[model samples]
Target: MLTLPSIYVLDICVFVFKNIDKFTRVEDTHNVNTRHKKRLCAPFSRTKTLSGSPYYMAVKIYNKLPNTFKTEKSPTLFQKKIKQYLIEKCFYSVKEYLEFCPK
Candidate 1:
């Protein structure tokens, strides 16, 4: 059966957190860090598909926000420019996250 190995999940979380400035209020670095720690501390379980996984659930929740929410993917050049501007405004405050692996 196909499943997302824990390493891939950690990488995705790191990527998401790093680029989180592109998305509005969906998650902060602290929140993502906390969730990552939770996942690391929890026991692993097999799932039938990646879509049923926690990562997918988090993405789904983020996508469900009202249209007013600013996400990395915008429909137009103007919106993209706007998003970039917003991200630049706060990028300095963001910190890098270290990836963790299970033994």
Candidate 2:
């Protein structure tokens, strides 16, 4: 027969498992793709951090900007505009931006 302490521990475990199932059900319908869409829709997506490394974040941000603003003819200007936008969005400090956007 199980002791009182053992029964209490089992009860707590069951409660946690049930809550976990509920949370998973709620999150499954709105997975990472849905979150990504919501992030993109937000005005601050360009400045937001990616799930991976800073390089990935920079590339993702670069890809999201309008093509008209990212012509090869003026790559420096394009980069400057992106940096300015990130700063305006209050994503990070100038130091952090430099660390993330290394040449």
Candidate 3:
């Protein structure tokens, strides 16, 4: 039951990543080349509460996803993968989900 929110948040992240083009890749906005270029650029936040805004939370969660999950091109496959992953992990909170390190 608790995992439902994590699954829902993951779905929202997937939607923003696949459908919304406003979020820029880390590589696009920076000059110093980094190996992890696929990450989304997290917007600046004035406070911790502001950092939890939908846009910021979406990027944070999306960035933490496995590379394979992030690269999935098909919406159905992405949803399937995320749902399977969340069910297996059974994350109870957004913070726990954020700190997950998939094996």
Candidate 4:
């Protein structure tokens, strides 16, 4: 069952964002800097493997989203845009997706 890692990441991000009350937002915490105010705060993961958990990964990927995408208010539109962007860019790996620099 081959599938795109980016799509999995996208779905995770959307789910997390939709259920934002379950997660900590940077703005809701005092520890995070103001620059990260719009992002979600990832929980501390002591082990490298633990950092790969869906919750952690979702925060990581969501925080990496372009500001334009992050600011989108409509879930449907955001999902559509991200899906199209993912398909067009065709990221080969999670690392590649993380390191992406949109121009």
Candidate 5:
């Protein structure tokens, strides 16, 4: 799939899964009952084409972002920064991004 070349999309998400706190500020929340308050995550579209894939959604979202969010820091830092940037823009992690994108 074309998305394979653009692995950053999956990398960014995997990073988010590995380090969810960095994105949600779960540490900052004051909730006592729940452990964390998840942000407004969007599920990957389920259409027939690549347009429904998380790769497509991620690329589309990244392309639309401003330069301010396009920092070239370390891979770890870059992921964290991108997470914050996306959250600020109201773009959440893929709610149900399966292991592979369907055709």
Candidate 6:
């Protein structure tokens, strides 16, 4: 059975999905392993097939967030929750995260 906390978390999940586009933006960063190249982090390659952006990416990000952080809080909390979750998961502070770029 879903407890009170679980219910609240479900509500937050719904809110995040409802505001998916608002919270998630297309991030332009270096290609998978090529530091010299850059591209949008969407799955679709061609313009015609590209559905503005892919739903999977946003869903993927949301799913990675910890359940403890995903409370039925305000919309602004989404990004903050993600940051907190990441810090806990990776065991790093803001400065350390900024310095540790993937190779």
Q: Give per-residue CA lDDT, model 5, range 1-103, as digits (tens).
A: 2133334454654444454443333234555454323331334456668676654555444433344444354656666665554444342234322322221
What tens-digit string does per-residue lDDT give for candidate 4 at 19-62? 87888887887865677687788898678987988778888888
Better of 1 and 2 by lDDT: 2
Per-residue accuracy of model 2 over 15-103 as CA lDDT, tens digit each: 33233332222234455554233122212345435434433433334334444443324545544554455545443333344345323
Q: Which scores better on lDDT, 2 or 4? A: 4
lDDT of 3 by residue, 25-73 (tens): 8888887788787788889877898696888888878887888887888
* TM-score to native of every candidate shown: 0.24, 0.29, 0.84, 0.83, 0.33, 0.32
Q: Report the C-alpha lDDT of model 6 over 26-99, residue by residue, as the tens digit.
A: 34332256532222233545565444333543443345444555454565566556444454446333233334
In model 2, which regions exceed 4 Å deviation? 1-58, 92-103
Ranking of predictions according to TM-score: 3, 4, 5, 6, 2, 1
| lDDT against the true structure, each candidate | 0.36, 0.38, 0.77, 0.78, 0.44, 0.43
Which is better, 4 or 5, measured by TM-score? 4
Poorly placed runs, candidate 3 (over 4 Å)? none
Look at candidate 4 and tell me the lDDT of residue 51. 91
Better of 1 and 2 by TM-score: 2
Model 1 C-alpha RMSD to native: 13.7
RMSD of each: 13.7, 21.8, 2.3, 3.1, 12.7, 13.3
Comparing 2 with 5 on lDDT, the higher-scoring candidate is 5
